[model samples]
Target: MTKPVAIKRRIGRPPKEDSVETSNRIIDTAAQLFAAQGYAATSMEQVASACNAGKDTIYRRFPSKADLFGAVVDRLRAGVLENLENEINTIADSGDALERLRHLAKWFLSVNLRPEMVAFKRIAMSEAVVFGSAGQGQTDKDPIMDRLVGVVEDAQRDGLLCGDNSTVIANHLIHSIVFGPSNHAMLGGKQYDDPAIRDQYFDQAWKLFLHGAGQ
Candidate 1:
C-alpha cells in the first residue's frame, strides 16, 4: 500500500483584498469613462484599459455594461444624498423651514450643475430614449429622495409645514426646484455662477413650495 501523504497548502495573495481593490478600481474607471463618453458609447474594453486591467477583470466585477452604468449612477446618487444630509443637519432652528429649504435647494442645484452630474444626466436621458418607458424603474428610489423625505417629515412634525405625505411632497418640491436650473444647464446656457442668481432662484422655490405647505 502506498504511504498516505499530507497535502501542503500554499500561501498567496489574499482573494478578499484583491477583490476589494479591483472592484473599487473598476467602479472609478467606469464612472470616469461613462461621464466622459456617455453610457451608451462607453465599453468594457475602455473601462478595463483605463483601469489597466483586462476585460475579464471588469466582467468579474460587473456582468455587463448596464450593470457598470448602474453602479456609477448609484455612486452619484449617494454623493447627492450625503450633501443633502449635511445641509439639512446644519439647520439650527425648526422655525426657519423656509431658510432651510432655500439652502438645501441652492446646494442641490450646485451639485446638479457639476460637470460630472451634467454628463451623467445627459447619458441617462439618452439611454431613456433608447430604452423607452421601461427604463424609468431603473432610476427609482434614489437616496437623495429618501433624505429629502426625512427633512420634509421633520418640518411637518415641527409644525412648520402641513403636508400629510411628506415623501410625495418632497418629490414634488425637489422636482420643481431643480427643473429649471438643470434644463438651463442642459441647454448650454451660461453657468449660473453668480451667487445672487442662485439665491434668487432658491428663494423663489422656497417661497412657492412653503407657501402651499407652511402652517
Candidate 2:
C-alpha cells in the first residue's frame, strides 16, 4: 500500500511583512485610488483589494477611511519633497541661484499640470472643505516650502536677489506661479492641455518670479 503521501502545508502567517512595507503598500494603493476616484469615491475595501491585502490589515494601519486618505496625502507630500531635494542636490554647490529658481518654477509647473496630480489636488481641496485637512500639516512649514525658502536665501546670500524674507518670497512663488496656474488647469481652462500653451505659461511665470525676486 503506497500509503498516503504526506502533504506539506504553507507555513503560518505566510511570511509577515515588516510594518513599513505593509504601511507603504497601503498608503500607495490608497493614494492612487483617491487620485483616480476622489476621496468620496474611494473605499478601504477597494484599497485593500487593489493591494491584495486584507481589509483588516489596512484597518490595522489606518483606523478610519479618513485616516487612510490622510496617510496617502502625507506620503504624496513627502514624495514631492524628496524629489525636490534630489533635484536640488543636482545643482553645483555654487550654482546660479537664478537658474535654481527657474528650475524650481519649471518643476512646479510640470508636476502641477500632471493629470493625476491635478486630480489629487482637487480631491484634497474638496476633502479639506468637507473634513478640514484630512490630517495634512500646514503647508507653510512643509519641507518643500522650506527648501524653496532656502533657495531664496541662497540667492540673497549671493547678492543675486535681495530679500530679507525668504519665507514670504517662497509663499509668493508657490501661490502665484504654482497654485494659480494649477487651479486654472484644474478648472479646464482653454489651452491648458496644450504643451505649447503650458510652456508659454511656465516661461511667463519664470520671468515673473525672476522679476519678483529682484533679479
Candidate 3:
C-alpha cells in the first residue's frame, strides 16, 4: 500500500496582509504616536515602523501626514462619541435626569482625563492657536455637541432642569464639567487623572450646575 503522501505545508508568509487588520493596526499605531508626540512631531516613518509596515504601504494608505492625523483623530472621536451615546441611551426614563447627568459627567471626566486624550487635547489646542484651524476642523465635525444638546433637552422636559435654551444649558454643562477640570490640568493646575481630585471636582461641579440651572 502506498503510504499517504506527506502533507506539504507552506513555510513562507502569506502573499498579502489582512487588509482590515493591517489598516486598523496602522491607525492605532498612528493614534498612539500622534497622541504621544503631537502631529508636528510624529513622522510617517515612525508610524510605519511601529506598525511593522513599509513607508510605501503607509503612504499608499494615508497619502500625507495630515491625512494620517485626521484618520487618527477621527478614530478617537468615533470611540469617545459612540461610548457616550451608548451610556446616555441606556438611561431609563424613570431614572432621575440629574442622576443620569451625573453618570454622564463621570464618564466624560474619565475619558477626558486619560493620558492619550490629555496629550491630544494639548496638541489640538496648541495647533488651533498656532496653526489657526488645523485642528479645529475636526472639532467642528464632531456630533458630541449635538448629542449633549439632546440630553439637555431631555432634562428640561423631565423638569430636572428648568431651562428653555438647551444650547446654552448644554454648553454650560460641557464647559463646566468636562472642560473645567481638563482645562485646569492642561494649564498645569491640579491633575485631573487623580481619582480623588477628579471625583471632588465632579461633585462640586454637579452641585454648582444644578443650583445654577434651578434643578
Candidate 4:
C-alpha cells in the first residue's frame, strides 16, 4: 500500500494601513516618472521600484502602465476641477458678476500655475492631438471647463457678460486665464511657482475681458 502525504498552504497576512500609503506612493512615483520621461518611455517596473513596491503589487492595483498613467491623469484632472469648483462656489458674496469673474480668473490662474497641473498639460500637449479624442466627442468639454462655462452662462444672464454666445466667451476666458499662461510657461521652460506672477496675469486678463464685455 502507498501512503500519501498532505501539505498545508500558508495564508498571507492582510495588508496593513500602509497599503494605501504604498498605493499613493506608487501613483506619485508614476506621475513624476511620466512627467520627467514621456508616458511611452516610463515603465511599470520603474514605477514599482521607485515606490519601493513589488511588480505584482503595481499590477494588483493597476493592470498595466497605460492604466496607471490614465489614473494619474484622471487624478490631476479631478483635483484641478475640484479646486476650481471650490473657488467658484466661494464667489457667493462677490456682490456682482464682474467681481465674481475676477475672482474666477484669479482662482483659475492660481490652480493652473501649480507644478502638477503644468506637468499634466505638458504631457497632454506632447501627445500632439492624440489625447484630444481619447474620450467623448466633445474634446473641449472637460469637467473643469464645463463648470467654467456654466459660470460664464450665469454671468451672462446676470448682465455681467455681454455676448451673443456665452459658450464662446467662456472658451476665450478659460483659454486666456488657464491654458494660455500654462502653455506659455511650458513652452518657455519657465517655472510658475510665484503667486505674484499669477495674480498679475489674472488681474490684467480679467480687467481686459471685463472692460470689453461690461455695460
Best by TM-score: 2
Model 4, stretches more than 4 Å misplaced? 1-22, 129-141, 191-197, 212-215
Clashes per model (N, Cα, C within 3 A): 0, 0, 0, 0
Candidate 2 displacement at residue 47 in angstroms? 2.1
Arrange candidates by TM-score, descending.
Answer: 2, 3, 1, 4
Among residues 3 or more apart in sequence or in different chains, the pairs in candidate 2 whose N, CA or C atoms overlap within 3 Å are none
Ranking by lDDT: 2, 3, 1, 4
**Model 2 lDDT-worst window of ten:** 131-140
Question: Which model, 2 or 3, shows the larger lDDT?
Answer: 2
lDDT of 2 by residue, 1-215 (tens): 79999999976554556667888888888878887788888888899999999998888779899778777767777888898898888874645997787787678777888877787778766767644546645454577778888888888888888668889887877777777778986776646678888888888876776675463
Candidate 1 lDDT tens digits, 63-150: 7777778777777777777777777777746446645655666677788888788888877777885334323356465677777677
**Candidate number achieving the greatest lDDT relative to the actual structure:** 2
Which lDDT tens digits does candidate 3 get at residues 1-215? Answer: 99999998967643465666777899999988887778788898999899899998788778877777777777888889998888887875646776776787678888887777787788778776533433445445448778777777777887888968988887887788888778876775667667888889888988888886463
Cα RMSD (Å) per model?
5.8, 3.3, 4.6, 5.6
Point out the worst 10-residue segment of candidate 3 by lDDT: 130-139
lDDT of 1: 0.75
User: Candidate 1: deviation at residue 136, Å?
Assistant: 9.7
- Model 2: how large is the Cα RMSD against the reference? 3.3
